[model samples]
Target: MAHITFLLVVVIITALAFDFTNGFHDTANAMATSIATGALRPRVAVLVSAVLNVVGAFLSTAVAKTISGGIVNDGLITLGMIFAGLVGAILWNLLTWLLGLPSSSSHALIGGLIGAAWVGAGLRAVDFYEVLEKIIIPAFAAPLVAGLAALLATRLAYRLSGRADEESVTRGFRFGQIGSASLVSLAHGTNDAQKTMGVITLSLISAGALPTGSGPPTWVVLTAGLAIGLGTYLGGWRIIRTLGRGLTDIRSPQGFAAETASATVILTSAHLGFALSTTQVCSGSIIGAGLGRRRAQVRWSTAGRMAVAWLITLPAAGLIGGAASAVVVHGGTAGTVAVAVVAVAAASLIYLLSRRSPVTADNVNDARNVTVNPQPAPASN
Candidate 1:
């Protein structure tokens, strides 16, 4: 370990903050279907997901290595740039959450880092090839694969149970959802939590606290795990409603297929060191699951909105990250302080606005809560 600077401290804390948001934002990825199907109560689902997330964090560090060394030239960047990137990621996560959109938290973090690196150290600092190879290609491919798999699995599940008692089949599938959803949660920890570990490790390397290319230390893994686990326990009910009920009306069979497909895809990507988006994969699976069930309707309107959010996640977060980098890199301590204050203010505003029409474990499954609705103006005669 090398000397830890104040800026380094800020970067690590910000990275963990981003990780916390990642947990809640992507909680729907694992537990949404299960909750929607009543396989588990909302609070219980999140609690189970939260615990699996912590345990999954200790499973692997391959994705962490990729973040620390593969995407950008850590040699060319500084602690300020990293902090700026984290700020961008955090803001995007919060904004999308407020809208009940299941955009990609993984992409937000990657795009922020890319934009900050490009601004701070010029284009040379960003490895475009690695970005395309590791992040871009997988982003498009993984979801489609998961969706297709879920579709097939759902079809097969129904076919096999066609002659069985409908009530018993639904009940059995619901029971199975607990296990499948748990696997997705474990997979979520393996992939998403490692991303924060990677970011923190990158900051450590930039600050000379760890040698370049070193993986996250023990403390980094533990803290990242705990932060995300806590966030998972809190849950993101707004997004959960969007995924669970908005995208499609999920039954136990469809929920089981979706969760199984999502878990398989996410776990495979984590092993291969691809920082894929669990949100996208899970959403795609839900859509597939909808298409598989007879007479089930996939809401393209809500899906369209979600798709647009996903398409813009990278560039949107990048622009914010680039702008933030300019301020932090050019303004010194005062600049960092200013960025922090603005971020806090913005986050607070989102939180307060969310409370005006709050979604919680209690009403997360209500049909009216399918999407995040703005508060209705007072009625006038």
Candidate 2:
């Protein structure tokens, strides 16, 4: 009993740690465009995002229920498996952040849980149908739908204001960007924070502390919200640079359109209990907004890299999770300790490497260093 209690404590703490990483990693999804367009200062953007994230966490538990009950069979999952899965997710989040890649934290968590469950309890432990209906399908569809919406919105926004004064339009949209970006931040909290809550709830269920099919406890919700909020406040400056400046150059109008589109898609998915990737949704929206504007350029190079990262996020995190689970299942407490130590060490190394070329708020909006081909000049009559 004492052993089970101790393991549960460890699992809960590790789950919160993963939640913290998810917060910072995905913060760019909400505030990147606003910061990029100077609609909000980098620090102010993150602070607003952090507060809205906590408020958003209390809005819905539908996504949390999906995570706790929809992914894997709780009956066969163990505390060690949960811990190992968190390790996998955390490592992937840190790796992507270090590289300035905006991969899906939702996918990382899902893949980690899937891999750990598969290795710990065989294939039968996973609910493939639910994963398809809730996770996989949403993963592909959310971004496309959000992209199209953003494209249309951007075109319409420009069309409606085409004859208006450019300066006034820019200022108006810059102000609008704040509200739209805040919506994205709130939507992010409602969607992403629930993932950690679900994980913690699942762990409690596996530990026999909570009944099977139960929602996240109140304390679980509060702590998970706080963990993620704190992480958001710290900011993921590396990823902010990537999303804000790497993918495309954003103007105030496009930022407004993109953020509005992203928020709508994310909020809808969360309401439906689909664990959609906010990063993918927001990235797609930004690209679409770029395309909608005349003469605007999308950095296909940076975008291609991000797409590749998204494609591999699930399988990559899963492999790590599976290996970690195998170790824990075979070597027990000692193995868990060893895996945790190695994960911490790896994370530290990545942080140190990132410091060599840090991306802080002070320079997050520095001129784009990557060379992009200039759009060809329009042909003269």
Candidate 3:
């Protein structure tokens, strides 16, 4: 029992580490557009996002319940399995972060869990039907819904204010971006932080520290909230650069529209307990906003690469999780140590490589010409 306690402790720490990565990895989901449009200074944007992320984590546990009970059979998960799963997620989050690709951290966590569960206890351990109904369907549908909503909202925002002076209009929308971006931050907390809570809860249940069918404990919610909040404060400048500049040249109006659309979709899914990808929703909204404005160029090449990352996120993370699980199950504590050392080494390397072309707050908006490119072809002729 003491050994089980020790393993549970390790698993919990690993889970929190993944939550930290998730926070920075997806900070762009909430704050990118606002920063791009100068609605908030980069530091101010992340500070607000960090506080709201903690506040948002307390709003709902429906998503948490879904994670603890819905995706995999709780009976089969071991502490080591949970640890392995998180390693998969953290590595993937770091890899994508290095590339400035806004891939889904939520999907990486889910895929890692599914892979570890499947490998640790065979295929029966996973609930494929629930994964389909809850995760997969939402993954495909949320982005499209968010994109269309943002497109419509962007058009409406423009049409309603078309006769107004351009300076006044931009100023008004810049102010509006602050509020809309905050909503996205709040929605993101409710959706994203809860996944970590679920993982911790699942670990407790597996170790008999908590009863089955239990929700995350109060302490679990608090710590997970704090960990993610801290990470958000750090910000993911690379991804912020990608979403704020690489996707399109966003104006204040479009930034406001995209943020509002993203918040609505994310909040709705959280309420419904769907573990959809907030990254994809925000990215799609940005794309939709780009398309909504007349003559705005949407960079298809950057977007195409992002799409490819999304498509591959699940399988790639799953493979890593599966391999880690196999190692843990067969090699025991030594295997767990081996995986940890390797994950740390890989993450350090990625961070070093990222320093080669660092995207920091000071120059986050060093504008890229999305229209006439020295790089990929523009979406517009």
Maximum-lDDT candidate: 1
Give Cα distance to truth, residue 361, candidate 1, Å.
Answer: 0.3
List, residue by residue over 224-324, the lDDT tens digit for candidate 3. 99999999999998889999999999999999999999988987876675667889999999999999999999999999999999988987888899999
Q: Supply the TM-score for candidate 1.
A: 0.94
Model 2 backbone overlap count: 0
Off by over 4 Å in 3: 61-63, 66-69, 367-381
Decreasing TM-score order of the candidates? 1, 3, 2
State residue 334's C-alpha deviation in candidate 3, in Å. Answer: 0.9
Q: 285-307 in candidate 1: lDDT tens per residue?
A: 99999999999999999999998
Output the worst ten-in-a-row residue range by lDDT, candidate 1: 372-381
Candidate 3 clash total?
A: 0
Backbone clash pairs for candidate 1 read 2-209
lDDT of each: 0.87, 0.86, 0.87
Number of the predicted model whose TM-score against the real structure is largest? 1
lDDT of 2 by residue, 1-381 (tens): 887887788889988999899999988999999999999999999999999999989887674454544677766878898888888899999999988899999788878888999999999989899877877788789889998999999999999999657888899999999998988888888877887888788778778899888888899889999999999988998889888888788888899999999988887876675667889999999999998899999999898888899988888888899999999999888888888889889889988877766778898888453212223551320
Better of 1 and 2 by lDDT: 1
Could you give the candidate ranking by lDDT, starting with the highest? 1, 3, 2
